[model samples]
Target: MAVHSNKTATLIVMLGALLLSSGCGNLAGHKNVDRGLSYIESHEYEEAAACFDAAEAAGENQRILYRAKGILDKNLGQYDSAVENFLKSLAATSGIPGDMDFDTNYYLADVYIKQEKYDEAVEVYDAILALRKRDKDAYYMRGMARLYSGDHDGATIDFNKAIALAGRNYDLRIMIYKALSSNGYEDEGKAILESCLNNTDPNMTNYEKGQISYYLGNNADAQSYLELARNERDMDKAPVVLLLGQTGEKQGDFNYAISVYKTFLAEDPDHPDIYNQLGLCQTNVGDYEGAVNSFEAGLALGNNEYSKALLMNEITAYEYAGNFAQAKTLMEKYRKAYPDDKDAEREEIFLSSR
Candidate 1:
């Protein structure tokens, strides 16, 4: 039940902002920093790390270098390191809030949210809003922090402000609904979604319609809309196909979902998220070996946001295949990489007795 939202889009925009901001400074390490950023975009994390190191050796601007390191650390799930790097980046700033400063603050707040330090996240967002009162993203994110912190009324106020500021942005509406629905405000979330559906604008694409329908529990309608979106040559087919496959799964047709994923992969094989989804469907159908292969294919693509999930699923596939030895082997590596994962710790304990 994954909702296609603006979180990734927001990060992409932040990365672009960092690049643009860094260009303002004349530095010897600009090329290295640029190369590192490109590697990060492609999920070549280790390569990105090396490039960042080279940039540091070449005496990159401390602000840019620390921010780059913060981005990399965040991607690697090294939250504390990311927090430290972001703080260093802030310290290196000229005390003038620019795009880089704003971007760094957003990332810092995001990391705090991930850590469940909602109050800290709220304070960061508060600072942003004080400086740029019209920042809709800050309002929306602050609302999320408030929601997670159990301040439902305050969350609603911020959400309303965000919605008013970005009224035409259907994605923002969907994101708000998702946040509310996931945080025990289902009826309120439903109302927001239903309003979006009722007030359908002509400018809305089939993909947007499909997303709304899916969230509204209209699986059949979601599938039809997604298929239409997929057929449009101008549309990005990956998300359309992904959502369509999810619609199939929602309909209890795992085989259909698997076939959909396979068909898409046969044509466009580079989508890591698609590979992860395909593996999940394979696992559901008891094709543990196929699932492992799918997961491995995704891992080979590189370390994007899906990397941790792919590794964890790969271990689960092996466990389900009655290969506790292989599962334990993988789990040990996973534990080393992500020692903070309580689920992984429990899985390790379970595997030890097997």
Candidate 2:
């Protein structure tokens, strides 16, 4: 239930490579490999893990196996294990220089950022930049590391370089603006966003405009822009749908939020985040049963990039429904599933007292 800032989404732009195929010739022929990729795309982490295990046992390249394991472990919140597997992946490819080089290093850096090891993350980005000088992702991610580490000037320089490299990419620029805004350079960020927001060029997508408005705290404008974006031909609906619900919720219109999120669910029932958000909105609107149902449905789908949030939401929904028995049961499950989560332990105590 934590509201994430741009800093918390440090790896958001970096995960594209990790989520896609491994592109290893040696591993491509394995039957289990395709199944694993399919499960990953479907957000079935458990099934993906099983597929990976089978692929590894059938002698998938150690480099590929280790990289896939690292991604899965990271998604499942096994950070230390992820670091270990990523390092193994790197070691497995040491001297090859072409197989798994960029993605392995990038994902390892992402895991370091998640662990708040900013210096380590910067070092990894440095390694990647050394390998390829013009890597825009490395520049952007290193900027995030520097931002969190309080090297604001260095971060600004990196962001400028990234913007130059990403030329005409409105989404990337908007993400940079959000990072700047959330990291204490709000005026500068708003100035940048305002330029894009004022652009009347047909090349400027409504989705980017909505994102800019949302970052600028213009929720009503964001809602309107996102709705128009959704109606645009051939536009990707997933992001626009989610942002519309978010804008409604931000404006404290839970009913409108619920209606839109449910509308999205009708066509895409497997999305864990929509269910998570819908559950929160239901809880806010005193629909405890619906909240619990939504939470449970999301949990049943397993980890969909926000494993911790889904688990905590379900526990909270149970508590809100006055079902302390189910809440405590789920709390125990959460504690076992995420043993390192001190926050959940504290929350368990608080819920017990209630």
Candidate 3:
């Protein structure tokens, strides 16, 4: 199995911003902080970091500065650096409200989880819960950490607490179900999903139901709901298109996946992820040349940080076409590019023997 990359939690960043807004900082510092937030919204993480630096240099609120720095570092996959900054933010006396300590601790815990330091994550979450006994997100995240650490029974207890606290929160319930199913509690997870499906609320969108069903492994229901949602007026087509391609791929309909990805590319030519999906579908259909082209185009989009899986997929396509020479070359390049990656090291060994 491919090692899935970690994602930064946007909830932590948003909460940090709310905490920052409670600041009594100088005008210039606040202005720079606002600029940093705008840069973050535009995905210019480096620029946001620079803005945070400037705000700090201008004697801004250290709490916001450290929190923003932590957020940017997390997005950049600098987990250790993010943890350092988040700790600093939490330690700062001013700017951050007392209640925001939970969020800052949550951010630190999440960073630890991304780093696969599950013990540290559990510790931080434990501390968060000790401070605020009713923090549902902390309980859920702690459960996730426990699950990752192979403490299924402990995870179940935390999940139960989360469910009890969540009450009628449909989204949170679905998230919990997904977490459970993904971590090997499929029966319990499916039961929750079935209950949700039977008690469908009129306020829920087909897209939401589709995502829920997809996570529940109900492919036919997922496809039906997603297709219905796609046809609705004023709908956002991007995610719908991607999920449709995924559903096709999951159902082993490579041709349908290829078609959907092609349609998506026409609408979003620069999208890096769809290209990887398109390449996978092409490779599955014995279209090695097309797969190579798609992977190349995706690499050309300059998303190196998120392109590890794309690179691996491309190399696999080469191998499937009996092009061991090219696969070996790509594997060597991958090993060089991500020297610390265990998977890349294993791939190098495997390709060398091939």
Candidate 4:
């Protein structure tokens, strides 16, 4: 299923400012546009706003300028400001009957998504459908809006419509894969994700491509993509690496799994998830002593409910591995902390019997 409303999202990367020519040179602040963009790139949102404000003040009044401002405000996490600019862009255009309207709606939906205002986003997407019922992006985005807003049935219908229209867009297809995963259709989702790597375009980052492969149980291919897409700031690499470790463990490659997890964890210390993962890895490798210590280290910095489970895990590993003294010590504290857990009562029984 896909979003069957909101006919906006990038139809093509190049059409970011569709139906608008760069020839409108004299209407407003034409000069500072690049400067505004530069400020945005540097993460200096206030400065970026100044540049856009100056252009708007100078009477640029062009939809293109508004689009630029939208991008700037989006980067600043000012969802309200971003939506205002995107709306201006849509309003300024005489009439975007098809793809152009799609682009605006897509960006607008994205802004609403960032704000977690999915109901409003769904309404905006509905408007897009009013213009072009068969628009693929609209259908896809509406599905997402509905999904986030707790309208599972509405979301599914939109997704199905999007798939019916054109399920080939890898970016669009990823939505289907994600929905399947969220709904716990893991095997079906994995198959869908694997099929996505068949086509290649230079613009598609390898890191993103790797994620699809890893999700499909293609560890080698995922690694190949990760190595090729190596960048220090890449948000995907660490997660992919972690996934690789998990894959290795699933395949009984303990040494390699541990190595991968440790290396990834080194770079992401204080990552509670990674710490928890590393502790699990250590336990599997028969390093129960190390497992206890690792979980202890994670517990110091990890203030999540998962930490309690991990502590209990460490206690069980200690008990199973015949570290009776240590198990007794942890069992006492665990019982005190999780008084209602039947498992804690059972652990006390086991300790008493021992």
Question: Best by TM-score, which number?
Answer: 1
Candidate 1 worst ten-residue window by lDDT: 1-10
Better of 1 and 3 by TM-score: 1
lDDT (C-alpha) at residue 334 in model 3: 70
The 10-residue segment of model 3 with minimum total lDDT is: 1-10
Query: Candidate 4 regions off by >4 Å?
Result: 1-29, 97-101, 131-134, 167-174, 183-246, 249-354
TM-score of each: 0.80, 0.74, 0.67, 0.49
What C-alpha lDDT do the candidate models reach, one value each?
Answer: 0.84, 0.77, 0.77, 0.69
Residue 156 displacement (Å), model 3: 2.9
- Most lDDT-accurate candidate: 1
Clashes of each: 0, 0, 0, 21
Instruction: Report the Cα lDDT for residue 35, model 2.
Output: 79
Model 3 TM-score relative to the real fold: 0.67
Query: On residues 201-285, what C-alpha lDDT tens digit does candidate 2 reach at each position?
Result: 5776888889888888999889889999989889988788888998998889999989998998898887888888999999999
Better candidate by TM-score, 2 or 3: 2
RMSD versus native structure for model 1:
7.2
Instruction: For candidate 1, list the clashing residue pairs, or say none.
Output: none
**Which candidate, 1 or 4, would have the higher lDDT against the true structure?**
1
lDDT of 1 by residue, 241-299 (tens): 99999999988899999999999999999999999999999999999999999999999
